[model samples]
Target: MRKVVKYLIVLVVFFMIPICILAHPGRLDANGCHTCRTNCAQYGLQDGQYHCHNGNSSSSSNSSSSNNSYNNVTTRKTTTTRKTTTTTKKQVYGCMDSSAINYNVDATNKDGSCQYEKTETKTEDINYDTKIKGNLKEGNKTVIEEGQKGQKEVTIKSVVDEDGNEISSEVVSEKIIKDPVDEVVEYEEEMSDSEALTILIIYVLNIILVMFYSKKNKNSKLIINYVRRIKIRIIKYIIYIIYFVYVIPVFIDVILVIIDFVKRKLKK
Candidate 1:
């Protein structure tokens, strides 16, 4: 019985040794190849390293996705901030009237830009004509009054450039110094023919009457010589007195009337 048990034990040991060798077929080296141990090769390798690549790659992809999402969010925020920070400049335009000499018709706004030309003034003397007042006969003139020239003050306005050239000028105001006086004159007129004839007839009649009276007195027969002589003297004296009193005044009046008429005609 002991011999038989020994043989059976040896056969059992030999069968167990073949089964172990069949289970592990590869040798142990740097490739990390294993006969009985399962390694990273079952999960796949990364950059030639023995590691659980599936888990690392999956975790890395998730992390990268998270990082990309975070980066996208940050980039979008930065772009929006930049857009909000930027600004545009404003533009303005207008016209300035204070410095300009002439009025501008087209400018819509005032910018305080304007230009002006130079200006000047001048003065001069003036003479005025005389005015006539009274009358004189045709073809006759006399200065009843004298005339004198008057003076005037004048102001001139002018625009000049920087070159000392005149642009334009105008009168600003005028004044008087002394007014002139007008002259007056007059002349006489001749008496009419009818008026002369009437005076002559009256003079001749008076002469005839005086002569007749004297002769009558000289030839008187009834009166005494002394009485006749006295009467004759008295008569002659009365005749002379009447002629002087009436005729002299009438002649003076006629002369005055003629002068007045001539003056009035000249006035007209």
Candidate 2:
């Protein structure tokens, strides 16, 4: 019991010294801060009896460091959410032969109807073999290229819609070609049977007229012989010669015409 009482007195004295020094800040002594047994504040020995000061090396400096650690973690969670966003850039290109011709198009909207389209196809594949090199300098700015080695995306979209309810039509095509175009040719020709028979009938009538010119005076009776004998037998010979040569072909042509007409009428 005596040892415990002695230990309790020592602890009481140690705690009371700090309270006394805080309440009444005295000058530093040669021995620095101390905790003595004499209660000098309650007596008349208060001038140099309770002189105590903090040592130069003490734990008071770390007491104020706790103020720097307060955070806004709760308010940050309520105000906003953290998420990762990805941004992308796209470019589209088209290509075709420059000398295209007669190309039909039926697009829905916003397109070239019948134009020859071409484009330059270029893509960047990083030349990693060249070796990009850099250095870190003091008191300087540094910027990082985000995605220098990644590939780019390209997209092209096309749509075609036609109205099925509209009536069918013959749309006249009119297109002006810029490049040298090939020549076009058109011909219209038709022959009918009536025109062909008119030609045949003219030749036949000419043949009948020539055949009736016998160039001799005939008897007035219905059937007469060669009565007026020829003083110009050569003329008569020429006349009859022309008649026989031309008349035979005409008779045969007339017979063919009659047969063709009969066949056509029977078919009808």
Candidate 3:
């Protein structure tokens, strides 16, 4: 009976070893854990549940690692979306011309609101007035002072197109750079000594001739009366010519000289 019992125990041990080896069909992970796909109740676990023979199980670790991976992927996606949004932002619009008054430095597009300005120098000729200083011969003139033109600076504000073509402009300010100078002229009308002497000699010759003619013709009353009448007519003609030519011109010159003197006094 003892021999038969020993042989039966050995056969039972061999059968139990194969049954324990084939109990779990899935392979183990690095943590010696696997999912219970079949015969879960035999190992005290639910179907598709993760378990481990070691004390530390991979269930919580794997869940946390998956959560972290998900968070990292979500963060990367969010960062990528932000970068794309920043890169595709709308462009700013304003005046892009550097010479404009309303130029914008941060603008990417031109909206035509630019206002431009420029400084222009302009010269205007101020006509010089002539001032007569003294009396002159009827057809003679002499310059005493020269005349000059004036200059001014003008600041202008303008509205222009993108191509620098002016659309509208207005004068902002003006300043005179140079003042005009007036022209001064002088004239004189004076008779020479030689001319006066010549007139005196002619008068003396005429008087002597009249006296001689009167004395020679005195014997006859009618002849003396006729000679006296001719002498008077000739004297009157000479006096009239002298008065008309010399006296009238001298009188006019004196009047002009008085007028110029009066004007100068008033200005002073």
| Backbone clashes under 3 angstroms, per model | 6, 0, 3
Identify the candidate with maximal TM-score.
Answer: 3
Q: Rate the local accuracy (lDDT) of all candidates.
A: 0.48, 0.41, 0.62
lDDT of 3: 0.62
Better of 2 and 3 by TM-score: 3
lDDT of 2 by residue, 75-108 (tens): 0011246899998744323222234332323322
- The residue pairs found clashing in candidate 1 are 95-111, 99-114, 99-115, 100-114, 100-115, 144-184
State how far residue 164 of model 2 sits from its true place (Å).
Answer: 30
Per-residue CA lDDT of candidate 3, range 15-87, in tens?
Answer: 8996676466678678766666887555545566665544443424332112211221100001123444446
Give the runs in model 2 whose Cα sits over 4 Å from its true position.
1-237, 242-253, 265-268
Q: What is the C-alpha lDDT profile of model 1 across 31-93, one tens digit per residue?
A: 332222333232222222321212222112212112211121100001123445767754443
Highest lDDT scorer: 3
Assess every candidate by TM-score. 0.26, 0.20, 0.28
